[model samples]
Target: MASTEFDFIIVGGGLSGLVLATRLTEDPDIKVLVIEAGNDLTSDPRVNVPAMWPQLQGTTSDWSFKTVPQKGMGGRMLEVPQGRMLGGSAALNGLNFVVSSKDNIDAWGADLGNGPGWNWEGLSKAFRKAYSLTTSGNIEKEGPVQVTIPEEDTKWPQVWRETFAGLEYDPTGNDDPFSGKNLGAVMRTRSFAGNAYFAQARSRSNLTLWTTTVVEKLVLEPSSTRVTATGVQYTKDSSETKTVNAGREVILTAGTFGSPKLLELSGIGEADLLKSLNIEPVIDNPHVGENLQNHPVCVLSFETDPANEEGFETLDKLTRQDPATLAAAMDAYSQKQRGPLSKTNCNAMAHVPLPGISTEEGKADLARLLNSTSTAAEKGKTPSAFAKKHEAFVHSILTNPRKASDGPDGRFAPPPSVSGDSGGHFTIGVMLSHPLSRGSCHLANTRGELAIDPNHLGHSLDVEILARHVQFLESVLVKSEPLASHIKTKRCAPRPEMGISDANEAKRFVRETAIGASHYTGTCSMMPRELGGVVDPALRVYGCGNLRVCDASIIPLMPRGNPMATVYGVAERAAEIIIAGL
Candidate 1:
């Protein structure tokens, strides 16, 4: 409350917030303020080091929000960990700098009516402007984020690419994931916002960042035509409550769960639900917290032969805490900033079209499944404009020969365990890129607690597609050469004795073991207001004049591969949009 006013007030000082602040403050005349709910752990090794990401969850940095029991997963609660620091979830995510497919982004403009700027051609430039590739002999030292594919000494990547190539898929189709498609066992980058965006601009005089401050609600001014956001009411240090005003606009980067929860808390949600919570109603939009989506992943772990260090020397050695290996890795990292510790063991991955889509039998099965699901939706009265449009977008990708619907990512490391029994493992995680299932997030009460229901695997279509992907892996990919020669016949995750007999067994396996990719989006989607969209093409909230959401929550559809690069690209593009308006 130093000046009691600023050009812009950002609710969350996470990834997008920092990017906007850094870019906006480039003009020395403009000032920006960022309020973060969690403290700045920029100096902590858990945030800086690439390998220590798994330990950040359940710590002070993670929000650690648990979803309501998912009926799709047999009434089990899944932990949805969101980063709560200055860098946000980017500080606590698996370092995979992947971009969305071109076809997926193109649909946002063509099918979804998001207009021209939201299309692939427009977004691709934004993606390039955000981060520069810093690989061997191809260094770009300009962009804010330094993205690098850590050099690997093992042959895991070669075997991984060759395995998929053996199945008649091109292993180099997506050598440059920035080209819009992520369809190959290419090595993605390991970069985070902490070491890049925030670190570069933290010392700016025009930018003020307040950590450990929670935003209560937006300060809105009501008029006959529209609602205007002037500022925000917040509690700092869990003590005195205060209000601040914004001179220009107020942006909500509170993330997927937090963004919608704040909107609902501030009375910008369904009128009945707001009134039920003893809160005054401002907007009657019921879609404020709807359209929640996530990429549900089914993991398949296999035991690898450890005798060949050329192919099997993975981070599993680090997981097992081998003293000699640990010492060597530390020495290499500290001395040259290169080693197994420099990046994750999940270096090889592929985003492929639905498994078996080339065969006539597979085409028939897919057609029958799609028709049945469509009929079910019609009978259940679930055919909203948004629903129909989304189904069509997914349909285009699933049936197209070039578009990808399933992502199979390979990890050379074993799952972490405290018993010290995890070792010599290779895991293939098949993630459903475009899930047909939809969910919601809302405030539980007036005091401000969120009831998040990701509703993962709620739709049978998601289950069916994921099951087929798993079946394809066990029957086709793992049995091929190079990769097959490096692994044993035993399974590490689902015991060796647990053999699948048919598609029914695969579906059951998916229902039991599927977990969220932690890439939650679409709570506050960007589409037409009539189509239950919370924001317009300009990313302005429908009923608010100066309020906008610039985080992952604004993503209309779940993108292929990881959403980290897309988030950065969106923020960069958003900064451009906001600046151009001025």
Candidate 2:
């Protein structure tokens, strides 16, 4: 292998990695190299078009990981698709832009001891510094990356505005901290220019982005005490093996799954797990692959009569409605980056406190569940209480007519059931913002292939919380005046097949079907090494000087919303840290 060195070696060219590399390279004196395992997607049409994302699944651009048989999922393996392109998962993601709660930032400071610098104010500044807002009035450009609202004004946007207004919620600025009330129209923010995906802003003069380069392992010094990172050994075009070096530092931005697996292969995980793989141990840290977390989501899809588009139609509607209309719309979008392809399909999202559930309550409940004395009974009690309270709050919120109003164009209808079939649709998805259950990533064999065992639905508390979320949705459909007309009370599988009607049944349903939102985090966590953390608060892997990790993997906990903004912010902040240290 030819040996070439640089000031910094960043593995993974995803959003986070690119941000770090681009920001660092702004100082022309420093050399930065970014190695990506996937191909360059600068002009990939599927990635550029907003609505074409769903079609990206099962494609080569996705890592397409399958979780090990989940005990909580009736021993079923679930498909977990992660982006493997230059922009990383962001290139293939749904392109939702939402920031975390202020409380979430405070919790991170309190839990990880990263100081107030990592708080909301600090993170917000970083967010502004990383993204360039394209919207006019109040929302000004803040960073290098451009952001804009979708051009296609679909019915979903109006629906979201009306629904939030009915709920007495107000649409505030994009960075406003979320409280239980005042839920409003979710402003659409994405990496788009006019109608196409935006990737040009991140391409910098000094940043060297290497595509289709998979990092094999982190080479260490003989002492194993001082890790030079040396260079990354990788497979190019999936045919040849080569090694490239970092003259000063190696930053692991290979994302959650890829980062931890690289660490393990380099003998930096739990001593026992490494021994199992017949690799010599460099560090006996048990937490390297531990504490894996993700946001689990359950989708709701409805069959709406086509006033907007017509893919599915009854014989009667087909005879009456214009079939050529939708085809023409699709064709138009494909050619000009306008029309339906510009729409994200999801216009808005609501964040509720679920009644008596507050940030403090969740923290305490999580601690007790994680370290409870009574296993079965205590597990049953806390979550049950939490669920009941949450469901009650949801019921009250939805049933109240004030909570069902939307902006103009019927954006918000009473939770589907109440809206009846006015050519409308509803989907009540419950997402666990922060989960207590954690899993790990390690080497399955020595051949370099990785294994990700998230152990999703492993925690009884997670099941309890998710179950309550579902029950709350059900209560809204049944009790809310606005939602009653649209309520299709057909209980689906796992819940109905098992004949589960009570709290237990709801919990079982959550356990069996809750899927990851693909927000995988905390594998190579950042904290003081004494607390079982791999990287320090500065994101440098402890005991390994000149080595750092700049990605979501370093985030100790999953925030309360989409992580894209946060990931970009972290990378921006990290570049400053690395530069200052230099």
Candidate 3:
């Protein structure tokens, strides 16, 4: 059995949790314990293999959460799959490495409530501290994660860049997207945290990782004036519960949904809600489970022209589980770690503003959207200080010329469809970077059951913004050459008969088909307490001295891309902050 005490007890062996464990235990005397809810599948082929990520879904490795029916999404319950294994979502994510733009990251300090050292300059250093970028265009030797633009087996990514360039979009040139401009066709990256960060540090004697162990709650020291977390109570394999002591501090890195749910369960949420549930209230912070934000994406798929089969080699056959193709892919990966089975389908992507944000008419339209039916009014309440600050940030991004919305940040060249009958096709994922809508995740009962409500497209402006981006994809992006030459006029989604010819039809289509990107954040916001903050700039929970949150939950503003890179930067910087205090 692992020791019952450590210098630090991390309450989730996910991506951030493991990063913290690895960095903190660099000192032989600093002991760390990571408690995870799932088993250690480090050696699982389904995890190590790149193309096999789709197979991990719905298996024991996935949390497989379903949001409450979102009225804005035609009353549909979207699937939010989180990783339940030791690597967390990194083990199950699509493996597209993208960093946020400087404008968006800087907004966290200038527009939002975050103070100094949270801007792009500060976070970008932390970003490079976690991952080494080694493509033909850019190369950095530092960091544990090996991020690279793989040599693809298809000509689609080149064709994708050329096509976008024809439409007046600039290629990233020699610059990787890390410079923060991020407005061109930069090749998406292939990287994972399981082997890069965790594997190297797991053998450390001072670092203890307990898989299949569920953290029930944080052990709080009772005090009327201040809140302090001293340890955690957890269970292993449905066995009897046990408590572990934290010698210095207790950190919550259980991700967006898990972190806030843990907070509420540990008597640290809204006072009235805890009292009604017959649980003792340690700290009365209503924002612990509020400010939930997620990137909503609508995938537009096109039927690939059968005649262009030579230049447009996609994973259509493999995705359909064709016996021969699967066997060939398995043999190639098992033998040489090269071939179609080695990388994810995503290769080419761009972060652009709403179709015509530079024009005067575009500014007027956005201003009208911002002023009409404010965030609090739409939710049938008065706006809080934080809500207003959030609104201003949205306004700034929408109106700014330099900042792009990550509309269709990702466009996949290979066939992503899993339908048994799904033939050759190309797909583009249109994503809203900074959504104005905010929902929440809270405890459903005293048993620690959760009620997750993403409220996708809850704000009326979200529908308008995302619909405009979708229309741009069908009308302009798909119509361009090089890419258009390969795809047929007929589309798999938004079929020819669907009549998505205008903005109204596009809005309806968005409402019917959009789903969450699973890049959940902002539940435990980092800001001043008066601005509805759960944790302060130092990442310490308000009214608590030793308790802190270091994960996606503490992101006050949503970053512009896949959020994997941003998470790593935040975790790397957090480790430094924790170590400095020690």
Candidate 4:
């Protein structure tokens, strides 16, 4: 029997793991250990600064993995960036703190019958627990994360709210976005932990964290018919390998990409892949590496007229192109939390369905392209591994309870000014709220890094939906008042010159412009065994005792907006689930 160093051994010290460690250690008696691969970046400017999020990609803070050339996406490869630091992507991401609607949460829980605890009412409590509700009546203020809701009088958000209200695209319906309906333009909250979520928890003497350490695999001991996970195998430097036992459970909170890779290495995936990798099969669970989903986004930017330059232009200067400007902004932020650094990459948001959202002809055409057999032809390839399941997912997203009328088919957010940009910027983007595409992350060898393929826009249906949004936003929607008057030049991606009506042209355009929203989920989905789920609704990994996953990886589906708030809530609920078992 291995010596148990802690009651729970958490694999990653990322967002979810930190939340779990804090929750579990509140009892001071329970021992927990968090093993993190990246160095503790608590106060690293690359992490704490919201504007520097774009700068961190492909840098030390990012995993910097690239997708296998996406055949569906004009044979172009995408830069799949995952945070390698302490808070994981949460620390490296654009600080847009937002949550899903009640209807959206129900789709993942009650509607799918996941569990009572997974539903809206159940998770809403976790939402409040994770962040103290601010004056916006949306987020929490006193929690580990400091959430700043943009004042109603703020310039960009004010303009966006008025523009959206006049258009009647979708009324916000309620003041608090967390109350459920978030349809109109509203200023969003941004999370600033002040390097705290884990730092503050250091006072809890029962917790231990290993930084700059890599988790090799899980320590599974088999007994006759079943396998029990006792602990984890990890190493600080390749020269030394150590095993830390977990008396209660071994939780894998290693994000969407890291968790599934850990499971595969531990011999809990498809038999063929394991055999090929020379790893012994312990569970032969095919679902362990399947069901990967992420939101696909595209930005359509326009050059704002210099004469019409308002507060939006000041945003461009704050990107810190000059040393003096950067120093000045930092000085201002220290004095008062109100500065350009306080703003998010996106200032305001809206959700809308295209003009043809309900048309029969549109649906039929999409169906033809998304059909399991024909989809490969669109990509100029043979059949894909997940063709049929993704085909079904495509139809479901379009026909689910959250369709054009109630839940938006796509989301729109005001764009941030880019550094070194020639002119003022105004962008309208299309968000594939529920993407049909699937991808996987698995190890090719015993190496620390894992091979990943997000399968971006692999489904032809996504291209069709996003193309429609682009056409509508530019030709039909943006051509409307206050918004149209501000645009001076046609400096945009999927340029206005491209004929969007032509299907081939639209497909080519979508392929060229699409980018990942970094909201990766469903890799280690919590669903029923029959549906090829890796984890149960209780968050326990199937076919294993004392092994579980608590992170974005367990998110069975992608929610509407930024996943930070949702991920935080999931961690909060995971604490409840783990406590019940204890």
Best by TM-score: 1
Residues 1-582 of candidate 2 have per-residue lDDT tens digits of 356677888888888787777667768888878888888765666776665665677888898888877776677777888888877777777776666666556555444567666877777677667655544344555565556555424444444445445655554434322222222221322362212212433455556767877888888774734655687788877767778888888988888888888888888877888898898988777778666777766443333334434332221221223467556656767577565546554445666544223346644654464354222343321233322322333333323333321111111222323333333344455676556556777678988666677778766656765666666655442334433433344433223344334678777677666677788887887765655478876888877777788888887766656677678778877877787888
Candidate 4 TM-score to native: 0.87
TM-score-superior candidate, 1 or 3: 1
TM-score of 3: 0.94
Provide backbone clash counts, one per model: 0, 28, 0, 7
Query: Cα RMSD to native, each candidate?
Result: 2.3, 7.1, 2.5, 4.3
TM-score of 1: 0.95
Candidate order (lDDT): 1, 3, 4, 2
What's the lDDT of the predicted structure labeled candidate 3? 0.79
lDDT of 3 by residue, 465-507 (tens): 8988888888888888888888875567644466676878988
lDDT of 1 by residue, 95-207 (tens): 77778878778876546778888898888888887876655567765577776654667788779888888877876632455766442211322356766787767788888
User: Which regions in candidate 2 have their CA more than 4 angstroms from the true location?
Assistant: 134-139, 151-155, 164-205, 302-326, 331-336, 355-425, 477-501
Query: What's the alpha carbon RMSD for model 2?
Result: 7.1
> After aligning candidate 2 to the native by TM-score, how far in Å is the CA of 221 from where it should be?
0.6
Would you list the rank order by TM-score, best first?
1, 3, 4, 2
Worst 10 residues of 2 by lDDT: 404-413
Which prediction has the highest lDDT against the true structure? 1
Per-residue lDDT, model 2, residue 433, is 59
Model 4 CA lDDT for position 297: 77
Model 4 scores what on Cα lDDT?
0.69
